[model samples]
Target: MKFFAGAAVLLLLFALAPFASVPAGHRGVMTTFGNPSDQVLSEGIHFRVPLAQKLNLVNVSIQKGEGEGDAASRDLQTVHTRIALNYHVKPEGAVSVFRDLGNEPGERIIIPAVQEAVKAVTARFTAEELIAKRTDVRDQIIAQLRERLARHAIVVDEFSIVNFNFSKSFNDAIEAKTTAEQLKLKAERDLQRIEVEAKQRVAQARAEAESLAIQRQQVTPELIRLREMENQRMAIDKWDGKLPNVAGGAVPFINVK
Candidate 1:
C-alpha cells in the first residue's frame, strides 16, 4: 500500500507541473538553454519542462495603439501631435521583431522610428509654416514613418496635429498688421469716392453755367415778341374786371382773383 501510495503522489505532482496555456490568437515560442529553439507551440495547452525549457507567450493577434505627441520646433515652438498605429504581428516576422527589438514593439521600435521621422520632416518647415501647412507636415511624416517602420512590421494607421501654438507677440503683431492694411485700403477707397464726388459737382456747375449762357444769347427781338404775345393772350383770359399798367418804376403785384 505504501509503495502504490508514493507512486500515486509522485504522479499527481508531475501532472501539475509548470506549463504555459496559450489561448487563441497566441503563440508560444519554446526556448531551450535560454535560446530560441526550433519548436513552436500552437494555440492550446502547452507544457514546458519545469526549468530546462521555457515557453514565451507571444500574441499573434492584430493589435492597435496610439502614441501621443511630443516635440519642439527649431525656434522653440511647441508641437503637439498624435498618431494612431495599426499593426499585426508578422505571423512570419514575429521572430524577427522579437530577435531584434525584444517584446515591447511600441517602446523599442515604433516610437524611435516615429520620433526620427517627425524630427526630420519638421526641421524643414518654419514655425509659422508648420502651423498653417500642418496637413502637409503630417503627410510627409506619415510617409517617412511607413517607409522607415516597414522593416519592423509596424503599420501606421493615421497621424494628425492635435495642437499648434505660437508666441503671443508674434500672433498679435500679425493681427495688427492685417488690421492696418485693411484700414489703409478703406482710406484709399474713401479718397477715390471723394474725388469722384468733386468731379461730379464740377460737371454739374459747368452744365448750369452753359445753359444760362445759351439762354442769355438767345434773348433776341423775335424771342421778346413771342413772349409779349403769350403774355397778352394769358392776360385777356385771366382778366377779372381789372387793368394792369406797367410803368418804368416797379410793376405792382396784381391780384388775379
Candidate 2:
C-alpha cells in the first residue's frame, strides 16, 4: 500500500507538471516532441503537456547591445566605427524570432544589421563629411538598421555612433591640411594689412609734398619785397625826434662835406 501510494503521488505530480508559470517580461514557446509550436504563452501561469510538451521562455523586453566595425568612406579612407543600439523583439513575433534566430537575437540579427548599415551609410559619405554631419550619418544608420532588422521582427528603438576612429596617418594629414589653411589665411590677412599701410603712407607723402609745394609758391620775390617794405615802415613809425651821433660811423641824414 505504501509503495502504491508513493508511486501514485509521483505520477500525480508528473501529470501536473504541465502547469507552468512563465515569468514577467517573457513569453513561453511551446515545443511538442522537440519541435517548436506556433502557440505562445504570455507571462504568468500556463499549462502544457507534462511528458511531450516543453515551454521555453523568450524575453520580449528591450535589450541593449554594442559593436564595432570597420568600413571605407567615399573618399577611400578607412573608418573604424563603434555603435550602440537598443532593440526589442516583437511580442507577436517572438515565436518566429525564436524559431528562426534562437534565444540570443542580438549576436545574429542586431549585430549584423548594425555592421552592414554602418558600412553602407559610411560608404556614401567622405571622411570629412561623415565627421561634420554626424547627425545625418547617425540618422541614416538608424533608418537602415530599422528597415533591415524589421524583417527579422527585431525593432530598433535607438541607435548611436559611439565613436569614430581613423588611422593615425589620416589624422595627421588632416591636421597638416588645417594648419596649412590657417597659415594661408594669416598670410592673406597680413598682405591686406601691408597693402593698407602702404596706401596710407603714399597718401601721407602726397599730402606732405602738396604742402611743400604750397609753401614754395607763397615764397615769391614780390612777396619777399612786400614783407621787407612793411618791416621798414613799422621801424619809421617807431622812430623818435632825435638822431644818434657817432665819431667813426657815417651820419644818418647829413653828409660830412
Candidate 3:
C-alpha cells in the first residue's frame, strides 16, 4: 500500500511538470524540440508538452547597453566615441527574437547596432561639428539605431553619446586658434580708440588756430591808437601833479595832441 501511494505521488508530479510560471515584465517563448513558435506566452502559468517542449523567458523591460568604437569623421579625423542605449524586446516579437537572436540580444544586436550607427553618423560630420552640433549628431545616431534595431524587434527607448575623444594635436590647435582670435580682436579695439583720440586732437588744434586768426584780423590802426590813449590816461591818473626834481627837469607827458 505504501509503494502504491509513492507511485501515485510520482504520477502527480509528472502531470504538473508541463505548467511553467513566467514572471512579470517578461514573456515566454514556447519551443518544440528546439524550434520556437509564433505564439507568445504572457506572464503567468503556462502549459507545454512535458518532454518535447521548452519555455524561454524574454525580458521585455527596458535594458541598458553600452558600446564604444573608433571611427573617422567627415574630415578624416579619428574619433573615439562611447555611447549608451536603452532598449527592450518587443513583447509581441519575443518568439522571433528568441529564435533568431537567441537570449543575448544586447551582445548580438544592440551593441553592434550602436557601433555601426555611430560610425555611419559620425562620417557625416567633422570633428569640430561633432562638438558644436552635438545634438544633431546624437539625434542622427539615435534615428539610425532605431531603424536598424527595429528590424530585429529591439525597440530603442533612448540613446546618448557619452564621450568623444580626439587627437591631442587637434585640441591644441583649437586652443591656439581661439587665443589668436582674441588677440586680434583686442588689437582692433585699440586701433579704433587711438584713431578716435587722434581725430579729437586734430579738431582741437584746428579750433585754436581759427580763434587766433580771427583775433589778428580784428586788430587795426584805429585799435592801436585807442590802446595808446588809454595808457596815457592811466599814467595821468597816477601822477601827484608834481614834476621830477632831476638835474634835467623831466615833466610827465600829458599827450594833449
Candidate 4:
C-alpha cells in the first residue's frame, strides 16, 4: 500500500511541474532540447513538459523604446538628435525572434538596431534636412529598421525625432539675418511713404499756380478799370489827419482841409 502511495505522489508532482501563466498581451515560446518549436502559446495558463520543454514568455503588446542619433549639418557642422521609437513583435514571428535573438531583447537588440538604422539613414541627410524634412527622414528610418530587424522579430512600430541640437553660433547667425531682413523691409516702406507725400505736395503747388494763371487770363480792360476804382475807394477810407494836393486831369479834385 505504501509503494502505491509513493507512485501516486510522483505522478502528481510530475503533472504539476513547470506549468506557466501567460499574462495579458503576452505569448509563450516553447523550446525543447535547445531547439525552439514552431508552435506558439498564447496568453493564460499553459503546461509544458517539465525537464525537456521550457516556456519563454514574450510580451506581444505594442511597446516603445528611445535612443539617440548624431549627424552633421548641411554646412558640415555637428548635430545631436534624440529619437523615440515604438515597436511590437509580429505574432507569427515571435518564436523566430526567440530562437535567433535571446529572451527579453529590449535593449540588447531592438535599441541598437534602431540606433544603427537611424544613423544609417540620417547620414544621407544633413541636420537641416533632418529637421526640415523630419517626417520623410523618420519614415525612411522606420522602413529600413523594420526590414532589417523583422528577421529578428523586432518589428518597427513608429519612430520620430524628439529633439535636436545644432550649433549655437549658426542659430544666432540665422536670427540676425532674419532681423536684418525685417529692418530692410521697414526702411523700404518708410521710403515709399516719403516719396508719396512729396509727390502730393508738388501736385498741390502746381494746382495753386494753375488757378492763379487762369484768373489772369480772364482779366480784360473793363476788369482792370473796375479794380482801379476799388483801390481808390479803399485808399480814401484809410486817410486820417492827412491831405494830398492832386493835379486835376480828366477827373477834377477839390481840396478839403
Among all candidates shown, the one with the greatest lDDT: 3
Error of 2 at 98 (Å): 0.9
TM-score list, all predictions: 0.63, 0.73, 0.76, 0.73
Name model 4 segments beyond 4 Å from true. Answer: 1-18, 195-257
> What tens digits encode model 3's per-residue C-alpha lDDT throughout 56-175?
899999998777899999999999998888899999989878888887898888878888888999999999999999999999988898888899888999888899999999989889
Top TM-score model: 3
The 0-to-1 C-alpha lDDT of every candidate, in the order given, reads 0.74, 0.89, 0.90, 0.79
**Residue-level lDDT tens digits of model 4 in 12-94:** 97786768777788788888867888888888888778788888877778888877767665557677889888888877777
Candidate 2 accuracy as TM-score: 0.73
Colliding residue pairs in candidate 4: none
- Off-target runs (Cα >4 Å) in candidate 2 are 1-16, 196-257
Instruction: For residues 1-257, write the lDDT of model 2, one tens digit per residue.
Output: 99999999989987769688889778889998989988878898877888888889888889888889899999999999988898888888889888999877887787777888899999999999999999999999988888888898889898889999999999999899999999999999999999999999999999999999999988989999999999999999998957876688667686558
Candidate 1 versus the native: TM-score?
0.63
Q: What's the lDDT for candidate 4?
A: 0.79
